[model samples]
Target chain A: MTLWQILILASIACFALKLTGYVIPPALLTRPTPARVANLLTVALLAGLIAVQTLGQGQSLVLDARVPAILAAAGLYALKVPFIVVVAVAALVAAGIRLVT
Target chain B: MTLTPETNGAARASLAVGLATAAYGISFGALATAAGLDVWQTCFMSLVMFTGGSQFALVGVIASGGVAAGPSAIASAALLGSRNVIYALRMSPVVGSGWMKRIAAAHLTIDESVAVSTAQSTPAAQRVGFWLTGLLVFVGWNLTTLVGALIGNLIGDVSAYGLDAAAAAAFLGLLWPRLKHLQAQAVAVVAAVAAALLTPVVAPGLPVIIAAIVAVVFGLTDWLGTRTTSDTEGAPLA
Candidate 1:
């Protein structure tokens, strides 16, 4: 498909995702079962996205700088550094590693 | 009408975060241009997909030669974006009025806006922060994307200068702040490991889905544990 087609399709899909929750009754959202399920689903979805970005590569795994970057990010986060600093540190470290080795 | 402290704070925080996020849109635009998309296409993605992950995924996929690179790239992006739906749900209670407002809210409901808004102590702050962050990011991201795309077209090969790191770094920037809690840390570790393990085996984005499942399971169990104990007090369980 063309770029426009892709954009249109993707846009539609995103809007649909956003709209689905809105259209659902607010009462349904407040219900215990749905609320619990939604919480789980959110966590799961985030995990999946992080995994795919960090790990998956062109339908396969490379496990290069991204791995180390993630580790560094985690470490910085553990140390309680600010978000921007952690990300910059990780990127710098990854870039250094890539430059050196 | 007088503005409460919460509303005032929300407005300020939103502006700060939105502006910060918008600055990164330049990087995205530059990256997209380097990947071979025209300025309009890049802007289109910014306007339509709007989500950073999906936009990056789309550009990456297109750069590598469309679906030949991997169909899962798009799917993975979509999955990653799934979290926003939850954020919107939570936000609906606070900022769910008016058709125009709702549409605008949905567009602005990103991780930064949600976290900042939720972190605020009071309702007014939450409302202010949410809208401010949303509007600022929306405007900033689009403008930056345009600038980056234009610059990228002129610069060529941004990877050589480490431009590629910007997006990943931006993502890390977003994820870092939430690590304050032990649960958040645990979830990050579990998700990262899961992603690493599955990336090589599954489709490009499937690993994310798998990791998400793991996180959901952990979160659910934790929720259940908390709920069971809270029930003892004869209070409504969250």
Candidate 2:
């Protein structure tokens, strides 16, 4: 399948996800169980994505130059650094590591 | 009938955050192009998918040699995007029930837009913040994507400039402010461990999905525990 085909499908799917908000009765989402689940979902998924991106490469997982950047990002973020600076810090750390070794 | 003098943080946030989001799009455009997408495909993804996380997920999978049109890539992006549905729900009453606003808001219901709008002190400000932020981001994102795609190779060795770490670092930045709650931090730890452990054995995208199950379990257990405590307190054994 071509990338275009995939784009079409993905776009439609994403559009549906957005439309679901207006479609689902607000009552269901307002319920405690669903609301709580929704609240927790974003954090978990984001962390999960970070781990995968940092630790894994393609099909195989390995430690690499990405580690220091992730750690730096964590530290700067904890310091309440701005988002762009946090990204720049991580990138600089990673680039420095690659330069040294 | 006029909207009051812009009197709140929402307008300021929208413009600032919209620019911030646009700055990030450079990496997305460069990455997508590097991953073998043509300039237009990269732009189209930004135009169509519109959500940052999902677009990155798609490009990430493709960069890793996974099938772009395959189930895993599509499914992963969709899952990341489904969070927008939740955003939509929270925003609906605020944006209103009209077809025009509803459709427009649906397109703009992303993390930053929602956050900026939420920070508003009034409903009028929310509507203004949401629309203004969304429009700026939409314009900025697409334009940067084009620039990035065209200048792909010139950027050269994104790792050399720390661009490679950009995605992970950005995600961590997004996650940090939310970690104030101890339970939220625990959930993040659980997810990180799960994704790390699963990455070696599972496919590229599956680990994230697998890790999300941990959150669902955590939420369920807490909910059930609260219910039980409430029930038991209501009726003591006499």
Candidate 3:
């Protein structure tokens, strides 16, 4: 129930998932439907993950600097400006907003 | 020892991507602390989880505030991490025949390793590339995490740098490249909107899980829509 406990539990679960790939029948991993779901599920997970991290705050949602930061990252990424630049741009923009406000 | 072109490429990728991706770890360290993890916990997650996407998502859940964010965080992290299972399809047979080697490979099998191996021209090179990238990334990610965690402690105030946004943006950049198709874009949009809307009403971690269910719907329907009509002749659902 504590943070460390949650982390420990998550770690165990993650190890299981990775090991499943190694141990599961190859036939199942090769199947198209599961593969399709896994691929899209990754996209979905990213979306959900991004959405919460961008706006979430202590069990609630709020608009904040992450909005413009994320938008800047998305814009730079689309341009292929390079990965580090993308992260730096977002960080600078968000920090700029915080400094001013 | 002599080097081949493929071996050279693997080594180059190991250094380049390994270091680049490893540099990103500073952000994870800063953000993980901003999200309430101690330096030890942050490093521990990187060590045990060892997957970027899942580690970042777990931090997202923690930032949203729940010590018992167990189910949803694990579920989302596990779902994203399952891509390794798919990667395993390409990597499982190629890496090793022996159980010991396979076990080691399983621990190291990740995006960078998988990419480096597949780019190689031979089984020997693939094996070399896989271990090289995997070990480097593992070491680099953890090393940078320590550096960042130490700095984060010194900084003491996470909001000073707006690392929450930085972390979110960094993670978005990671996911952006994979959204190549219309269906993938649709799934991301639907999941985002669902999570955003649900966050206010649901428990901290549950919104993401709910968004995941929404994604499953989109994925299944998309698959069904593309199913060849001939193949579905006997399928009542079609």
Candidate 4:
């Protein structure tokens, strides 16, 4: 498909996605189970995205500097360091490891 | 009617978030350029399908050659972006009733804006935070994508300098603030593990969906317990 086609399709899809929540009846969404699910879904999806970005290769999993980065990030987060600082420290550590080995 | 101090504070906070969000747009532009999209195409993506997660997913898919660089990538990203649907639903009531404001609200309905606005205690603050973050991120993300793309062109391959980490870092920045609650942390851990395990087996976005489903299950159980306790309590005097 052409770039325009891609963008159009993507935009339509995105608009629909944004619209779905508003279109759904509040009664259904506000239900205890569904509301809880929605709340949980946000964190879960975020975690999933982070995991894939940090760990997965094109199609495989690689336990390289990303492991150490994750470890460092988890530690930084545990220590209540700022988020940017945690990420920067993790990335720097990863880069350092890459430089060394 | 006079503007209260709270309203002013809300506006200031929203503006701050919006400006910060816009800075990220430069990165998005740079990454999209690096991934092989033209300027107009990148701008178009930012303007129309303004969600960052889906946009990043689309570009990532294209860069990796996981899906064809057309509707398939968009579809995958859109599926991954379905969570925003839920966000918009919760936001509608808070969004109030002007056509212009509604359109603006739709454009600004991203994760950061939604979170910031929803977390606010008052309605005025929520509105201010949502619009400010949304608009700021929108502008920031697009401009940054362009900047990143231009820089990418100059540098040849961004991977050499680890420019790819920009997106991941930006996401981490956003995610870190939300990890305040135990349930949120547990959900993150479970979902991350699930996604990692599923990545090898499923398509690009499917792991995220699976993780979301798992989170939903956990949330349902939690909600059920909370409801049971509330029911049992029967409005006891505080």
lDDT to native, each model: 0.61, 0.73, 0.75, 0.64
Cα lDDT tens digits for candidate 2, A73-97: 8777767777667776787788888
**Per-residue lDDT tens digits of candidate 2, residues B1-238?**
1466553467777888788788767767876776677888999999988988778777765655456325656776787676688778878888877788788789888877877777678888888888888888999989988887887656666556766577788667656765655566788899989988987787677788788887788767663233221111100000
Interface RMSD of each: 4.4, 3.2, 2.9, 3.9
lDDT of 3 by residue, B85-192 (tens): 777666777775777877778777777788777777877778778788889889998998888788777777665687777777866866776676666788888899
lDDT digits (tens) for residues A1-77 of candidate 1: 56666667776676666665555666655444444434444344444444555544556656666667767776776
lDDT of 1 at B152: 81
DockQ for each model: 0.37, 0.61, 0.61, 0.49
Best by lDDT: 3
Give the fraction of true interface contacts kept by model 1.
0.31
Candidate that beats the other on DockQ, 3 or 4, i.e. the better one: 3
Judged by DockQ cut-offs, the docking class of candidate 4 is: medium
Residue A62 Cα positional deviation in candidate 2, in Å, after optimal superposition: 1.9
Q: What is the TM-score of chain B in candidate 1?
A: 0.74
Scored on chain A only, each candidate's TM-score is 0.72, 0.86, 0.84, 0.74
Note the clash tally of each candidate: 16, 0, 0, 16
Per-residue lDDT tens digits for candidate 1, residues B1-238, read 2588667777777766776677668767876887677899889878777877567656654543454434554554566556566667767876867888788788777766777777788877877777777666777888889998988888776444344454444445445544444555666667768766766665544555566665557555663233422100110000
Per-residue lDDT for A1-101 in model 3, tens only?
67787788877777777677778778776755666676677778788888988888866777888798888888888887766677678878888998888
For residue B215, give model 4's deviation from the true position in Å: 2.2
Ranking by DockQ: 3, 2, 4, 1
As for lDDT, the candidate ahead, 1 or 4, is 4
lDDT score at residue B187, model 4, on the 0-100 scale: 77
Question: Which regions in candidate 2 have their CA more than 4 angstroms from the true location?
Answer: B6-9, B157-162, B223-238
Better of 3 and 4 by TM-score: 3
